[model samples]
Structures are given as C-alpha cells and as structure tokens.
Target: MLSILKDFLLNLFFILIPIFIVPIWIEEKNIPKHIKRHLLTVCFALVIILCMTIPVDADREFISDLRQIPLWLGSLYKGAATSMFLCLVTIGYRSLFGGTGFFVTVIISLFIMVIGIALEKKFLALSSKHRVLLATALCTFSGILSIVLAQTFHRIPLSSDISLAYLSVQPICMLITCSLKEMIYKNIALRKRIIRAEKMEAVSHLAASISHEIRNPLTAARGFMQLLEQHHLSPEKRKQYVRIAIEELDRAEAIITDYLTFAKPAPESIEKLNVKTEIERVIDLLRPLANMNSVEVKTTLAPFTIIGEREKFRQCLLNIMKNAIEAMPNGGVLQIYVSIEKQHVLIRITDTGIGMTKEQIERLGEPYFTTKGIKGTGLGMMVVYRIIESMNGTIHIKSEIHKGTEVSIYLPLSSNLHDLTNEEKKLFMAL
Candidate 1:
C-alpha cells in the first residue's frame, strides 16, 4: 500500500511539471494555436512514457499507474486528431511489455478515449466548476470500468488493500490534476481579459485628453473670429486680433502634433532642459494674461537642469502656472522660485489666491476633478502628474482656504550640472 502511494506521488510529480510549464512558456513566446496543441500533445506523451516506464507493482500480478489522466485530458482539450495520436502512442508503448493485461490496457484506453471525445464539446462549454466535476466523474467511471474488465479478462488475483488503493488513489489523482489544469487555464484567461480592458481604458483616456486640449485653442480662435465681424474697428486693432487668431490656430495645430507624437509607437525624445530658460519662456508667454488679470508675476529662477522631453516639460509648467494665474481672479501675486536641494532641483510656485481644502488638494490630479467647476475640463493637472511621474519627479501641494497655495516640484538634477563650477552656477542663478 505504501509502495503504491509513493508510486502514485512520483507519477503525479512528473505529470504536473509539464502541465504547469507548457502554458506559461507558450504564452510568453506567443505560440500559435495549432503549434501549441501539438506541443501539448508531445509534452503529455513524454509524461505518459515516464508513467509507463515506472509502473506501480501491486502483488506482482497487477501493474498500474496514472497514465489514463493525461490521456483523458488530451482527449478533452486537443480534439479528436490529438486523442487518436495519443491513443496510438499508448497502444504502441504498452505492446512492448506483452501480456494479457496489455490487451486490457488497450480496451480500457479505447473506451475512455471514445467517451472523452464524445463529451469534449460539452466539457468545454461547461463552466469551470462543472467542467472539473464532469472530468472527475469521467475519470472515476473509467477507473471502475478498468477494474471490472481486468477481472473478467486477466483474472489477476489482487488483495483487498491493493484494490482499494488503486480505486481510491487513481480517481483522487485524476481529480487533482484536472482541477489544477483548469485553474491555470482560468487564470490565464482572466489575465488576458484584464490586459485588454486596461488597453481600452487607456485609449479612451487619450481620446478625451486630445479633445479637451484642442478645444481651448479652437474656442479662442472662434471668439477672435466673432470679434472680427465689427465694421468700425481700427486697422491696427483688426490686424492684432487676426494675428492672435492665427497664433491660436497654430497652437491648436501644435497641440495635435504633440498628441500624435504621444500616440506614436516610437520612443519619446528626452533632453537636458535649462530650468530658467524654459520657465522664463512660459512666464513670458503668460505675461499678457497676468497683466490682463492685474496679477503680478515674480520669479527667483536658477539655471538648474533636469532631464525630460522639452514639450512635455513645458506643457507641465504651463498648466501649473496657468492654474495659478487663474486662481487669483482678484489680482494677486504669483511667485516662482527654483533652487537645488538635496541633489534635486526644486521648483516652487506660490499663489496668493483663494485656496482649497485638504480634501480638494488630495484629489488634485484625479480625472475630471477641478476647483474651477464648469469652466475646467480637469485634465490639465492629471497631465501634469503623468508627465512628472514619467520624468521620475514628484509634486507636493500646500494650500489653506482664503490664504494661498504653493506647489513644489522636485526633479533629479541632471548629471551635466555637476560639471559646472560653484561660481559659474551662482552666476547663472543670478541671471
């Protein structure tokens, strides 16, 4: 009995190794279905050979092992052609050790294969739990049929303990092996579903972002076009409105180009950007808006360097500063400061605007969350967060209601910045 138990465990170990390995291996390699089926057939054939090569001897009159489990599994999964091939392999291999029992093995194997093929479609259509139950039932029936046929044909005398061991162990082995294979297949299917869902969600987000970003400049251009209908306007005023409209249209074009670059499969362009140069450019661009709102712009920018894509970094800064400017509808100060701290270049933008609550602050970068209500699409900060994260940087926000808000951005200092002398760095900072 102990010997039978050990043999059963050994057979199970050999069978399980390939059962678990083949699916993951083939999935990673992106193997085709037809080829994958053949690979499974070959692997299971090897397992069958291992099981047959080392048979469990009970009283020397009975020879048995768990070879039927793999045969049944292959039949149910790989279709009729594969089942036929495995059947041939089993019959051919068993013929080597000729006996009356060989004929019994042949008869029993054919019986199981026929039943398995008949139920293959039904088994596949069943839900996971039902499939496991049905397969287990089939295996148990096959075991019973084998015992009855063996007694009728070979008349091999077997002790009660050995018979009990054979009956109990084989069905249990079948149940376990079938259950594990089913679970693995189920998990693989679930993972594929999750990956597909994530991809669809990303595409939806990209579409929304492109729509939101392009809408602003287009809206601006439309407003200027509406203003151009006036018949009494000065020549210079009319020309200024036309130029601004054209610039707004050009910005819309640039935005579409940026989004196309983002959606492309090619790699993004990264470069070391001078902090002062980029921030000053954005500040200059928004200077007119600041003046229009009676908001004062103050800066203490240093020529610190950080690594990131030029457009994305500029976009991130623009969103942050634009929000700061908009926050102060009643005309307040927007302070920008930059310095190196603990090997990181820190960008601190402070605004004397109507501030936010802790709850609002925590939800800043979440999609469609905004302090500006209907006037905001709420994607700007989300874009800022994603771009900063891509550059391996972090943003920290501090705000108190009716007082002010400060946003601190920390990015790793560029390696080239280390080569600059302290005096040169100071001179650059002063500039």
Candidate 2:
C-alpha cells in the first residue's frame, strides 16, 4: 500500500517535470520541429514505463505505473498522431514484459485517444478555464476506466485498499498535474505578450523624442532657403538651388512627421472622406517626381468613400504613392486601383520597384525596418499602418524577389450618409 503511494508521486513528478522541459526544447526554433517531437515522444514513453515499474506491488507479478498520464496528454496537446505513436510503444513495451492487464491498458488507452481526437476541435474552442476543467475531468475518467477494464476483462482481483488507491490517488494526481501545467504555460505566454508590448512602447518613446528635436531646425532651414530664392541672380541657378533646398527640407519634415505620428497621434477630426478625390490629388502631386524617374502612374478609381480625417487620408495615399514611385527608380509602372467588395472598399497599390523577400515583408510595420536604403528612415510605412488601423482597415502586402510588390488596403465604407442603401450601410462598420 505504501509502495503504491510512493510510486504514484514518482509518476506525477515524471509526467510534470517533462511538461516544463519539453516546451523549452520545442520552443527553440534552432531545433527542427519534427526532431523535437520525435525525441520528446520517445523520452516520454520511456519515462512513463520506468515510472510504472518504480512502484511494483510486493507480489512482483504486477507493475502499477501511473503511465497513462502521458498517453492522454500527448493526444490532448500534440495531436492524434503523436499520442497514437506513444500508445503503440506503450502496448509493445508492456507486452514484452508480459504484464498482467496489458490488454486492458491497451483497450482503455485506445478509447481515450479516439475521444481525444474527436474532442480536439471543440476542446480548442473552449476558454482556458474550461479547457483545464475538461482536461482534468477527461484524465480522471481515463484513470478510473482503466482500472475497471482491467478488473472486468483481465479478471484481476485487488484488495479493497488497493482499489481505493487506484480510484483516489491516480485521478487526483492527474487532476493536479493538468491544472498546474495549464497555469504555468498560460503565465509564460502572457509574460511574453507583455514583454513585446513594452518593447514597442519603448521604441515609440525614442521616436517621439527624436522628432521633437529635429522638426524646429528643419522648418527654420526651409524658411531661410525660400527667402534666398527671392534674391535670384541667374534664374536657372536660383531655380536649381531652391529646388534642391526645398526637396531636402520637405523630405526631412515628412520623416519628422512620421516619427511624431508613431509616437503619439493627434486626435482625429473624423468626417466622411471622399477616397477617389483625395487619391487623384496625391497622384497629381507626385506626377513631377514620377516623371523624373520615368515611372507611369495608372489609376482605376471607383469613387469609394470612407469615414476618416481627410488630411490624414490624403497623407496615407501620398506616403504609399511616394514609396511606389521611389521603388521604380528606373522607368516602371505604378498601378493604383480602387474597388468595392464585400461591403468594403479595397485599394491596391503595386510598384515595380526592386521587390522584397518574405522576411522583409513580415517586418513591414516594425520600427526602423525598411528595404529602402539611407533615403528611408522606415517611419513612413509605420505611420501608414497606424493610420489604417485607426480607421479600422486591413492591409496585406505581397512581394517576391525581382517580381515587384503589391499592397492591398481594405477599409469599411462610411455608414453616415443617407445615399447608402440600408444593406450598404453595414459594409464599412463590419470591420
């Protein structure tokens, strides 16, 4: 009797200690995922088998390894494939040792796995608290059902004390282990999320500080350059100097504003904005720059309207088109298309610039991340992302090496106007 309790404690320890260790291995991307799972599965089977042996009854004919914990856990956490693999190993290992009630263990383990897979979809849909409750309940059922199957099918008779131990100790250990494991893993994931948010906040603060320091000087320089243009000597020479000074100052000021937007966005003066009109204005504004690069601008605007501040909406278009134009430093085509779909307005901007790798696209909105050389501070796209998010829109970017890049922005249509049909009003706010 005392041996059974000691063995149960050992079994619980083996089951849980590895829960913490395996996550460490699996989370390390340096290790190939398949290798980690295979290694952990084999390790788990061995540990459970060893744990079951540690508490053999005094009769020496039977081993009371609380080993089923890993079988159920594998199915619940990993998937049907891994748990089934572990099940086969457990059955073969037990049979080799000619264990009593081996067939009973096999039957119960198979039943638990089938149920695990069937429940997996719904199980995952449950909240964390409910999942923990369900896991504990299922594990407890598995432990108890195994004992009943062994007694009924294998005709294994146990003393009342041993039966009580089987009913109480095994189920309780499973319950406690499941609860502890769930709580620990949840806390770890939550801690990671908190750390990521803090890092983004820190970066925003740094950008804000830099923008405040640079804006005044750039504005002063631009004003002085404008005054010098009035005292024209050679008209050509004056025009050239003024152009150079103004371009440099404008670029600097644009970057500064991006940083400011990243740090702290001003309160939006939300109103109905005409998307087609604003986009045409930006296209006209960028025509000079686009011509110098020999890039042709093609537009297919479908007159979509959305709810957002007009100036900010114009800025969004300006930043995107400017990037598209810059992408094609040598002659290429920039296509801007707008359409309505699924009660939403879709804007696609495609540039034949040197395209980006998958890794660069994934880091698109991260601070200081850019494919553009020193000419880009990487804040422009960050502001683009921020504004789109503020307006409840979604953005998707697709690109490949040498194939150019395509950016798609989707925004909900404004519901405020009476011209929109009853069904059409729901299109924008649906996001």
TM-score per candidate, in order?
Answer: 0.61, 0.52
Candidate 1 similarity to native, TM-score? 0.61
How big is the positional error of residue 302 in model 1, measured in Å on the Cα after superposition? 31
Q: Tens digit of lDDT per residue, candidate 1, span 275-309?
A: 99999999999999899888999998777778888
Q: Deviation in angstroms for 108 in model 1? A: 1.7
Clashing pairs in 2: 52-65, 412-428, 413-428
What does the lDDT come to for candidate 1?
0.83
Maximum-TM-score candidate: 1
lDDT of each: 0.83, 0.76
